[model samples]
Target chain A: MVDEHADPTVGELSEGAILRSILDRLGASNALVGPGDDAAVIAAADGRVVATVDTLVHGPDFRLAWTSAYDLGYKAAAVNLADVAAMGATPTALLVALAMPDSTRLSFVTGIADGLRAACRELAPGCRVEGGDLTVSDTLTVAVTALGALAGRTPVLRSGARPGDVVAVAGELGRAARGLRVLFERFTDAAHLPVPVDESVLAPAERDDLAAQLRPAPPVALGPVACDEGATAMMDVSDGLLLDASRMAAASGVCIALETAALGDDPRSALTGGEDHALLATFPHDRPLPAGFRRIGRVRAQGPDPVLVDGARYEGRAGWDPYRDWDARTG
Target chain B: MVDEHADPTVGELSEGAILRSILDRLGASNALVGPGDDAAVIAAADGRVVATVDTLVHGPDFRLAWTSAYDLGYKAAAVNLADVAAMGATPTALLVALAMPDSTRLSFVTGIADGLRAACRELAPGCRVEGGDLTVSDTLTVAVTALGALAGRTPVLRSGARPGDVVAVAGELGRAARGLRVLFERFTDAAHLPVPVDESVLAPAERDDLAAQLRPAPPVALGPVACDEGATAMMDVSDGLLLDASRMAAASGVCIALETAALGDDPRSALTGGEDHALLATFPHDRPLPAGFRRIGRVRAQGPDPVLVDGARYEGRAGWDPYRDWDARTG
Candidate 1:
C-alpha cells in the first residue's frame, strides 16, 4: 500500500535519482545545513552536543516478512531519539546510513524516509536528517546517529543516584515484550513462515500491546522536563527494568529497592521486559516527581546486590539479550 | 595470530564482555562524556558541529579475502574523516556501529578497534571513538558517523565555486583505481579466491600503490589549510575526478574545465578512477593555491556540460559505481 508509485528496484534506478526522491520526501529541516551537502551543519548550542548511535540489521533485528519498511524506519528513529532523550537533551538532528541489496525495491527506501519524517514530527519536532551514505550490501541494514543540544544544562548521568532518592519511570513497560511473545507464537504456529494474523480476534489491549512491540512510541518529551525537575540520574529501559536498574546501581554505588505493588503486581513482567524504551530516573525524595512519572522504587545505600524487591534480593534473568545463544531461526 | 591471548569466536563471547574488551583497548578519549554513558558528549566549539555518516558492506565494498579486518576498519575511518575534512572542519569524534555474524572471531573485532585508533592517531589527533554499538547480524558491516568542529570558520561547500576560480587537488589520483585494477587481476588469477599475492614480483611503487588501495592515507592535513587560504569551494575525490567535478559544477552552476596534461597521460584513469579520498578545491584565480596543491583545471561559466576535458566534452563512464551490475561475484 505504501508503494503506489512506479515501484522500481534500486538496481533499475540511478543512485542520484533515488537520493533526489528521498530528499524530496524528507521535507524541510531546522538544521543550519541539511542533507544535500558533503556534511551537514547543525547548531550545537551551548558549545556541546549529545550524540548516540543505534543499528538495526535485517535478519537479526527485523524480519522483512514480519514488519513493514515503514515500521523499521520508525522504530530505528524512536530508538535513537530515546537515547538522546535519556541524556537529558533536546534531540535536534540525525545522520542515517543505509545499506541494502541491489534487488531491494525503491519503494521500501522511500517508505523508510516517510517513517523517519513521521517520527520526527511526532516526537522531536525540528529534528532533521542531516547527511548520510547509501551503499550496496548483501542484506538490509539501517544505522542512525542522533544529535541533541543540552542548552547549557548539566547532563543527568547514570552515576548520580543517592540514598533516599525516589526511583521513577516516564513511560510504559512489558507491553513490547508481551507483544513480541504473541508475534512469536503466531509465527511459530504458522510453520516458520509469515502468515497474516487475525488481529480482529484479539482484544483491544492486545492489539495496542502488539503495536507497541512493533513500533514503540517513547516519551521523548519527558527527558528535558525530568532534567529541569532536577533528576539525579536517568537512562532508557532498552534492556528492561531490572538490568538497567542494576547498571544504574553499579554506576552510582547504590542499591535500588522496587515495590511490587507500585508496579501493578505484575512484577516479573514489569521488571524483565525489554524494548519498552521508557525513561527511568531517580529524583531527590523531597522534590516532587514530574507529571506522568510514576514512583516505583527508592535508591538505597550500597547493599549485597544492586537491586532488591521489598528489601530482599531477587535473582532472575534480567532481560532479553541478543547474543546469548538464543534460537537464531526464530529470533 | 592476532588473538594470541584468548582465541574465541564472537559466539563464545557476551556482548558485555566484548564491549569491555573494546573499551579497554580504546584507552583514552577526548570526549567530555566518554563511552561509559548512554550517549557521549562532545564539545561543539563555535556553537556548531559538522556531521556525516558512511556505511561499508562486506561483499560490495570489500572482499574479506583481499583485505584484513585492520585494513577494513582503517579504510572506513579514513573515508568518513575525509568527508568531515571536505567540509573544511577539524574532525573531532566518531561513533561506530558494527554488525557481524556470530561466526566472526573476537580478534577481528579487536583488530578493527586497533585500526580505528591508528587512523585517529595518524590523521586527526585528539579525535576519539566516543562510543559504539555492537550487535549480531548475518553479515559483517561497519557504519561510522563522524563529527567535526568548524572552530569559527565558515564551511566550504561544493556549491561555492565561481567562474573565475582555479581548480586544484592536494592528493593523488589514478593510484587507488589502478591499485584496484591490479588487485582484481591478482584476485582473478588466484581463481576467485583470497590467495595471497606475491608483491615482490611488482615494482616498489606498484606495491605502494596497491597498499594505497587497501589502506588509503588521505591528506587530511591539507583540508584546513585550503580553508585558511580562502577556498571558494571544496569536496573529496571519492567517486573519481571527472564525476565529482561534474557534481561540484552542477551544484555551483558552473563548468569545470580539466587540463588533461596536468594529470598523467592516462587521462581516463585520472578522470574516472574512484575512491582516491583526495581533497579537491577551487580558489580565486588571483589567489595562490595552497602549498602541496597542484593546479589541475579552472572553473568556467555555466556551459552545456558540467565538465570538459581541455575545453572539449569527453563522453565516458565517470567512475566506479557500486550499484552497477559489474562482476557479480568478484565485486
Candidate 2:
C-alpha cells in the first residue's frame, strides 16, 4: 500500500512508507519480533512487564510554532520513560501511535523518529521502538506506551509514605515552566510563524531555559537508585510540586510539610512550577539522601490540608489541568 | 482536578471525574497495579509479551453517526485482540489512551469503558483493561495497545509458510464489508445525526451484518489450535484475503494459489472484502486441518505474482489504506 511515486512533502505518500521509515530507524534491538508481523514480541525477563501510556495533542500539549518535531518526539519519550522510572523499573521498549494531518511533512515524521531513538539511546540504553500505528487526522497527535522490566524488585507505590519520611526531589524544579513563560513572551505576537530563532541572539539563560522546555532531560536513572536505596513512596512531578505533593499525601493519608528555605530561592516558582519531569520521593528520615537528590520537605500526620507551605496554607493557583480550555498566555 | 458537583451531561466535569468513572468500570482484574498509579504491571507468564497497537481516528476510521461509543470501544478491543491471537498468543491485557473534545458527553466516556470490559469478559475471560490516559483534543481518538502471553508455545509468523502447505481460514468473511455498505446507505442523509437506531427496525440479516461490521468476533481460540496443529504460518485477514495472502507469500518467498470455488458464495466479497478480521493460516500438506478451519488454497513455489486465483492473476482494489483520505462512502 506504500505509494512510491507520491510526494513526501505534501504527505501524498501512504502510511506504509512512513511506517517502514520509522521502523528502519528503530531496528528494534530489544524486540524479539519487531514491526511487520501480526504483533511484536518482547521478553519480560522478570515474569512481569510494567506499562504506562501518555498522549500529547497538538494544541493543548504542544505548539508546532514553538517547538520542532524532533523536540516533540524527545519530550514524548521522556514523559513515558519518567513514568516507567517512577515505577522503579528498567525501561525496555515503546509502542508509538501517531496521528497527523495529510499535509504533514515527511521530514517532520523522520525527525520525530530521530529524536525518539536518540532519547532512548541516551536515557534508557536498551529501550527501542517495537511497533506502532500511523493514521490520518486533522491535528497531529502522538501517543506512547512504554514497557519496563521490574527485575524482581518491589514496585514503589504512592501509598507507602509514612509520617516520619523525608520528602526529596531529583532533577530541576522550575526551569521548564519558566522556559515556557519566556517562549510565550517572545513569540506571542510574531507575524512570521514557526521561524527558526538564532540562539546567539538570546541570553544564555533564556536559551537554556527554552531547551529545557522543548527537550526535558528527565532523571530516569535516579528513580531506580531511589528505589534501591529504599524510597518509601515515589512519583514523577509533571504537575506543580504542591499539587503533586498533595496527591501523594492524600493517597498515603499523610500531610506533606514543605520547607521554603530548603527549596531554592524564589519559593513560589519552585513550589507551583511544573513540567520539569523530575522525580519526587520520600525515604526514612535517617537514610542519607543520595547524590542528585535534595531534601525538600517532611511527611507529617494528617492535618487540616494535605499540604502545608512552610507551616501555612498556600492560597494560589496550582498547576496545569489538561481539561481546562487552552489559554495562550497562561499555557 | 476532579470537580465534585459539576454536571456530566453539560460537559462541566473535570478530567479526574471522567477518569475515575472509567476506572471504576474497568475494575482492573488482570492488573497487578492498575490505574491511579505511575504505571500498571501485568504478568507475562512465559517470560514474554506479545504486543500490538492500533489507532481509530474520528473521520477516517469511524463515523459517530452510524455507531455508538460502546461499539467503538468494542471494535477497538477486538482489533487488537485479533492481532495478538494471530501471533498464536492468549490475550492478557490492554492499555488504552483516549483523546477527545472537551464537549464530549460523560456518558459516552463511561459507555466505552463498559463496552471494553464486556468484550474482554466474553472473548478473553482473563483479559482486562490495565491502564489508560485521557486527554483533551478537537477530535475523539482511541489508541489501544494489547499484550498477550505466549504460554510457552512458539509464535506463528507469516514467514513460516513453505511450498506444499495447505492454506485455511477459520472465520466468516465478506460480512463486515457488506454490513458497512448497509450502514453507509441507511445513514447517508440523516438530518438529525448520531441518533441511536433500534436494531428491531431492521431486517434480522441486516442487523446481524451491521453487528459484524461494528464488532467483529474473531476466531481467537482457533489461532492457538492452528499453532498446536502445526500450522506453518498465520495472520489475521484484516485487509482482505488477497492482500494479506500476498503479504504472507512475499514474506515466505512463495506463491499463494486460491480456488475461488472453495470460498463460500459470493467469491468476490470473500476474496476482496476487508475488516472481517478472520484468521488465515497455512498447515503442512500432510497434517489434518483443524475442526473449524476449511482449506481454501495451497502454498506453491514463487510465481510471477504473489497471489493467484484459480490459476490466473486477479486484479482489484486490495484493502484499506488509512492515509488515502476521508471518503465516507468508500470507508
Candidate 3:
C-alpha cells in the first residue's frame, strides 16, 4: 500500500534539512526564545517550575512492528506530562531528545513530531514542544523532559497523606496492562517476536485496551483540579496502583487500604499492570471527592504492611520493573 | 589500578537500587521537590526559565574505549550547560536521562553521577541535579536538559546582530577538535578502532586538548555578565566558528567577518574544527567588551557569503555533521 523506497533515510539528508522537516510539523512556538535559538525561555509565572524526564527505549518500551512512530511520540510526551501533572502542575513545554539509527526514515521523524504536537494539544492544551536535540544512535530512543507551572499552589507531595485521608483515582486503571496482554497473546509470533496488530480481529473493548496501551489519554487536566480542591497527597499510578500506592504510603508513613470492590471488572490487572498514568490522590474524609476522582481506598496509621487490599496484604506480584522484567528482543 | 570485577553490573541489581546509588552521589536538593518525587519543582525566581537539551550518543558522540564513564557524564552536562549559558542565563538545575546497556557496571553509573556533580560545582555553581531517568538500551546515551534563570534581563538571541557590532568570544576555539585528532592519530589501531587514552605518553598541550574534549569548562557565568554588559547578540560556537557564525549570519541577516590573526597558535584548526562550545557574542562598537570576552571581528551588512574568513570565503570543510560523518563502527 505504501512505497518504502520513496521515503528517504535520515542518513541521506543533512542534519539541518532533517531538523527543518521536524520543525515544520511542530507548529508555532509559544516560548519567548523558541526552537531556532540555543535554548527556549518558558514563563514560570508562579516562580516555581515542575520538571521531569522519562525515556522510552525501543526493545524494552515498545516494538517497532507493534508501535507506529506517532504512538511512540504520543506515549513519550504523555508519560512525562503525567509526571508533571502528578505534582499538581500544568505542563507548559517539552524538550525532547531523540536518538535513532541512521537507517530511520525521514517520514517516521515527521510522524513523531506530529504525534508530539497532537498529544500537547489534547492532553495538556497550553503545552508545546519548545526545544529538542537529535543524534545518531544504534538504538531508537526518545527522552522527553517536561516542564510545568504550579500556578501559585503548594505542590501536593506523596508524603502529605494523613491517616484520615480518603484515597481516590482518576483515569483508566487496568486497560493499558490488559492491552499488553492482548499484544503478547494475539499479536506475537511463536518465536516470541511482535507482529503487526490486526484491529479487525479484536473486539471493541480489546481495541480500547490496545489504544490505551499505545496512545493513553491520562487525566492531565484533573491534576490541577484535585490540587485546587485541597488534595492531601498525589502521585501518578504508573508502575501499577499497588506499587505506587505503597510508595506513597511508605513516604507518608501510613498504611493504604484499597477496596477491591471499587476497582472495575479486572481487579488483578488493575493492581499489578503497569504503564497506566492514572492520578491517585488523597483528600480529607470530610470533604467530597473532586469531580473527576472516585474513591477507591483509605489511608490508615502505619502498620505491618504498606498496602492492604480488601483488608488483607496483597500476596501477588506488585508491578513491572524494567531491570527485572524486560527480556531484550527486537522484531 | 581499578578492580572491574568488584563492581556489580546494573542488570543484576534492582532498578530501585540503581536509582538509590545515583541519588546518593547527586548531593543535596536545592529544588523545591528534588529527586525521589514524581517530579522536581525548581525555583524560577525571575518569572522565566531558560531551558535546553543536548544528547551524546555512544558511537557518533564518543567512543567508549576513549571516554571514561566520568568523562562521558561531565561532557554531557557541560554541553547542555553551555546551551543555557549562551542564552544569557544562569543555570539553575539539570535533568539527566541516561540509557545504557544492561551489562553496564554500577560503579560506572556512580562515576557518571560524580562527574555530573563535579561539573555542576565547577562550571555552574548553585546548579544541581534535580531529577533524572534511567533506562536500558543497546546503545549508551546521555540526554541532559539544563534549566536556567535570566534574572529579568531580555534573552540574547542570534538574530539581534547588526552591522557595525563588535564580535567577541570567551572560551577555547579548537582544543576539543584537536583532542579528537589526537585520539584518532595516536589512540586508534590500524583498523581505525579507538584504544584507551594513555595520558602518560602525551605532551601537556595534547593532554589539555584531550581534557577539553572530554570535560569542557565553558564560561557559563560570563553569559549573565555579557547580558549585563549589554551584549546585542550571542550564541555557542559548538560546531566551529565558520559554520555556527554562518548560522548566526543567516539568522541576523548580516555577514560576520572574522580575523584569523585573532586565533591563537593554530588558526586553521580554529576555523574549520568543531565542538568548541565557546561563547560567540556581539556588543555595540562603543562600549568596552566584557571581562572574559576578547574581540575577534566585526559585523557587516548582508553580503554574498554568510561568513568571511580573513575577508574571503573559506573553501575547506567547515564542521562535522553526524549524518554525513559517522561510519557506524562500535569499536
Candidate 4:
C-alpha cells in the first residue's frame, strides 16, 4: 500500500513532488521514461505515429459547474483522438499537462483520470495514459497530446479531392450545439423550476445531435478503411460541414458543392452546427460508399468559394466562430 | 497579398478566422488538410514518425517581462523537439496551440511564429507548421506538439538500463539554473547601478542562460547515435540529474551510482541543476564511449535510491520543485 500523508491541494505540493507521486502510482512498466525526465517515452511499435494536441481553459471551453472532472478528461481525450482519427490513424498513447488552483480537490483530479481511462477504453483501446505534468495555477486548464499509428496505410489527406468526386459523411451531427443550448437555457431559468424540455420533443435526430456534441464518437476505424477503398480526399467535420468542406476545396484547388437537400431532413443543423466529429470524404463518383456512411455532397469542377445547396453561397452563420456569437451568447 | 484590416488581438478574431488566415498564408502545396477541419493531415513519406509535446504557462514558467512572445515559441518548440531527440527521432512537423490575453499584440504573435520557424530551422530542417488553435485567456500559454521520423532505427527507451551499464551524458548542465540566478540577481541589483559583479558578466551569462531556458539547444541527432551504439537505457535531462537519475533507476528496477569526479569541473551543477537539455543514457560497461559523450556513472545491482559520490547518499536538494521555492536556489 502507498503511504498516506496529509492531503494537500495541488498548491501544497511542489510540481516535482506531485509528478513524482503520480508517476509512482502509475508504475514504471508501461512508461519507457516516466515524468521528471526531460520527456517521457512510450513504445510506438510501428514506425509511423499520429500526433494531435488540444488545450481547454476555464470559462471558455468548459465550466466546472456544468461538467464533472471526469467529463472534462473524457472530452479532452475525445477531441485529440478525433484529430488522429481524422488522419486515419489509431491512437496509441497520451500525455497530459494540467494546471489548476491549489484548492482543487484530489477527487477531481482522480475523476479526470477516470474519465481519461474511460475514453481510452472506448475510443482508443490501444492508447494508455503514459505520463503527465501537474502544476498549480489560478485557473484550471488541461492540455492533452495524443499519439496514434497509421498502420502502414497512406494517411487520407484533405487535398486529394478531385472534381466530380462524391462527398460523403460518417456519423451524426448538430447534437453538441443543441446540448449546449439546452444547458444554457437551464442556467438562465434558475429563478424558477427549470422548464425541462420534453425528452420526446427532442427527435431521434436531435438526441443523436446532442450526443454528437457532448461525447463525439470519432470515426477512428473509417479513415483507414476509406483509404484502403480508394478515398481521394478526407477530413473530419469539426467546425461545420460547410466550413470544413470549403477548406478541402481550397486545398485541392477544386470546389465543393454540398447539397442541403441530400442532408435527409434538418439540413440547417447539418450545414451550420459544429462538433459532430464525423468523417467527411470525397470518392470516385462511380464507387459506392463503405458501410456506415451516407452521401452528402459532391466535388465540383467550377464554383466560387465552395458553395452549398444548388451551388449557392452560404452567407448565414454556417459554423462556430468562438470569438463571435458563441462567446457573446455564453457570456 | 491579403486584405489589410486593423490588427486585432487573438481574442478579437474567431477561431475559424485565425485558422483560415494562417492556412491561406501557409500555401496550398504544403497543406494536406488545412485548419477548419477536425484535424489537419500531412503526408509522411517514411513509414515511421516521432512525436512530442510540451506546455508553458505564464508566471510559473515564464514572465512576460523577461521573456518575449518569440522566446515562448522558441522554448516550446525546443522542449518538444528535445523529447523527439530523446526518442532517437528526427523532427519533421509541428502543431501548436496558443492561449493568450485579448490584448496581446499582433506583432508579438508574428514574433512567436518567427521564433518557431527559427528553432525549426536550427533543429529540424524542412519541417512545416501543420496546424494549431488559438484562444483568448487571462494569461499567455503555448502548447507545442512535434512529430519526427526514426530513419529505420529502433527508439531508445529508459527501461532498458541493466545492472552494470555505464552511465553517460551529452550536453551542458547548470546553464539554465545559473541563468535563473542571473535573472533574479539583475532584478534585485537594478537599484544599485554598477554594483558588485561585473555588468558584462551579468549580461553575457544571463543572456546565455536565458537562451538556454528559453531556446534550448536539444541534441536531435544524438539519440540515434546512442541507439546505434547500443544504449541500454536513455532519457533527456529536464529536471536536475539526481531526480532524473532516480526516476531512471526506478523505471529500470536498478540503482544508479554517479562518479562525482567524472562529471567535469562543475559536479554540483551536473547533479542538481536542470534545463540543460542533455541526453543521459546507460550502456554496457565494455562498450567504447561514443563521440561527444562523457562517462559519468554506472548502474548498480543494489542501492536504496539514486546515489552519488562513492556510495554516499545525496541529502542535499534533489531538483527543481516548483511549490517549494520560487526564488532562485539550488533544489
lDDT of 3 by residue, A1-331 (tens): 5566778899998889999999999889888778989999999998989999999999988889899999999999999999999989999999999999989999999999988999999999989999998899899999999999999999989999999899999999989999989999999888988999999999999999999999999999998999999999999999999999999999999999999999989999999999999999999999999899999999999999999999999998999887777767532
Which candidate tops lDDT?
3
Cα lDDT computed for each candidate against the true fold: 0.86, 0.85, 0.92, 0.71
Badly placed stretches (over 4 Å) of model 3 are A1-6, A329-331, B1-6, B329-331
Query: How accurate locally is residue A316 in candidate 1, as Cα lDDT from 0 to 100?
Result: 73
* Per-residue accuracy of model 1 over B1-331 as CA lDDT, tens digit each: 4554476877777888888878877878799898978899999979999999988888777778777888888888988888888889988999999999887888889888888888888988888799888888887999989999889889999999999899999888888888877777765554565555578777887787788888888888788889999999999999899989999999999999999999976678889998899988999999889897999999999999999999899887888666774345665
Residue-by-residue lDDT tens digits, candidate 4, B212-330:
77678877678778878989888888888887888788878888898888876667877898777788889899999789778988899756765555678888888876555443221
**1 versus 3: better TM-score goes to:** 3
On TM-score, the candidate that comes out on top is 3
Note the residue pairs that clash in candidate 3: none
lDDT of 1 by residue, A1-331 (tens): 6463578878777778889888888988688878877899999979999999999888767777667888888888999999999989989998889898888898899999988878888989988787788888887899999999999889989999999999999888888888877777765454675555568877898788778877889999899999999999999998889988999999999999988888874678789988889999999999899997999999999989999988888877888676774456765
Extract clashing residue pairs from model 2: none
In candidate 4, residue B75 scores what lDDT? 81
How are the candidates ranked when ordered by lDDT, highest leading?
A: 3, 1, 2, 4
Error of 4 at A159 (Å): 2.5
Residue B219 in candidate 3, Cα distance off native in Å: 0.9
Per-model chain B TM-scores are 0.96, 0.93, 0.98, 0.85
lDDT of 2 by residue, A159-278 (tens): 889999999999878888878777766766554234444567679888877887889888998888889999999998888898889989998999999899987866777788878788
Q: Give candidate 2's TM-score.
A: 0.94
Worst 10 residues of 3 chain A by lDDT: A322-331
